[model samples]
Target: MDIYQICPEFKKGQITLRQTETQDAEELLNCYSDEAAVPLFNSDNCHGDDFYYTTLERMKQAIDFWDFSYKNRYFVRWTIIINDTEEIIGTIEMFHRIAEDEFNHFGILRIDLQSRFEKQEIINDILEIVNENLYQAFEVNSILTKAIPLAGERIQSLLNNGYSPMNKRFMGYDDYYRRNRVDN
Candidate 1:
């Protein structure tokens, strides 16, 4: 499917995944500014550094970059909202892995959340949505994500959502989880 035509808004129960906007800078700042929460964010795909925005200005800059990337067909990103509070709590960014090597034909998912919302249930719910639809969303047969070994909560959530741990011998520091359509 054409990337531009694939934008979608997803909602299941209390969580809503929608296109992020410039106005979200402040809330996103709040989510990423938490000193404790910053370290838990996974940034393996973010050009080697964690895309943690500690201030509103930085968050806005990141949002601009996200917009530029979207316009350039680089990736798609969405802000996660808690319906009850109507507040942005996290973000999910994903792109089709179009490399010529081992990662060919895979969708890369990057999820960053405020420490408070990093519960197994919540992670499973959000990841479940991505796992079920990402194949078609990115037109790939499988999806991959990275969760460090020290992130026990995240590892459990990935396991609960049909993702199997990739071999450590091949993955080293990138504790990877993979879900393929054929697995069903």
Candidate 2:
């Protein structure tokens, strides 16, 4: 499916993933400005964006850029919301990589969340929903995400969800884990 043509929304339990909007700036500011969560964000190959916005204006600009990127088919970003509290906790970015290296045609998944929700269970819940859909949505052989050594909970969750450490570096970045669509 062409995700850019029709962005799909996924809902599972209290977690909801939908196309990000400008209205998300206020709540998402809390996630972008979160110092503790910033380090866990995968900003590799993002042209130094770093994903750290300190103000509402900056966050809005970032959202605008995300919209631009989506329009150009560069990537799709979704806001992660809690159904119960209706809080925007974070965002998930996914793109189809077309490179000359080993990652060519692979789906790159990036999950950024508030520091307080960085537990293994939370990560598992989020991944459970994404893993069930992104492979088909992005039409890729595998999906890759970053989980540095410091992100112990994220690493464990990835492992439990059938992901493994990729021995090779991704676009000169490290600490990436991979999950294939078909089991080997």
Candidate 3:
């Protein structure tokens, strides 16, 4: 049930994954509040200051969810870390686990290391997480990602890695969203 402690560190030559503790508040705040994180989480229902507060509130909610049911929400989230310096630069999470719903059996989410490593390594980590974790539990393994416009080559890299745009047309709701995310 303890996803953070359950998995061993992310074994690169020297990098790793360690459990995030309450002491990490300041560091996580700094990372999540960065300019790079804003676009990845599209401003869904607010603007300017409201959206900013909403973002922080959303993070609080996530942390709360993580603590809500340690067992099921074990898939909730984890702070990404580098083993050498013991610095937590970012995070990865399950994002959602629709237990009673049939649609999203095992959802995936991750946000980590804007500058720590090349985007390809992040993609590789994502693949590794999926292959080792989620794929072990679900029949279908998928991700819910936001197509941030300014990701530049990063977006192309994700596509190259077998990730596709889910609602490319965005004309109608397929039981997921309220607004039809038409690329108009």
Highest TM-score against the true fold, candidate? 2
Candidate 2 has what TM-score? Answer: 0.96
How do the residues 1-184 of candidate 1 rate in per-residue lDDT, one tens digit apiece? 5656667888866788887789998988877787767777766545765766677888898899998889988888899998889889989888887777676878888888888888887787788778766678788887888787677888898887779987752234557788887545
Candidate 2 clash pair list: none
Most lDDT-accurate candidate = 2
- Candidate 3, 156: how far from true, in Å? 3.4
- In TM-score terms, candidate 3 sits at 0.61
lDDT string for model 3 (3-85, tens) is 43364444543345554555655566656666655445433222342122235556565456555634554354566766667
Candidate with better TM-score, 1 vs 2: 2
Q: What order do you get sorting by lDDT, best first?
A: 2, 1, 3
Write the residue-wise lDDT of candidate 2 on 77-184 in tens digits: 999998889899999999999888867999999999999988887678788887888888888989999999999999999999989999788888899999989632
Which candidate do you rate higher for lDDT, 1 or 3? Answer: 1
Which scores greater on TM-score, model 1 or model 3? 1
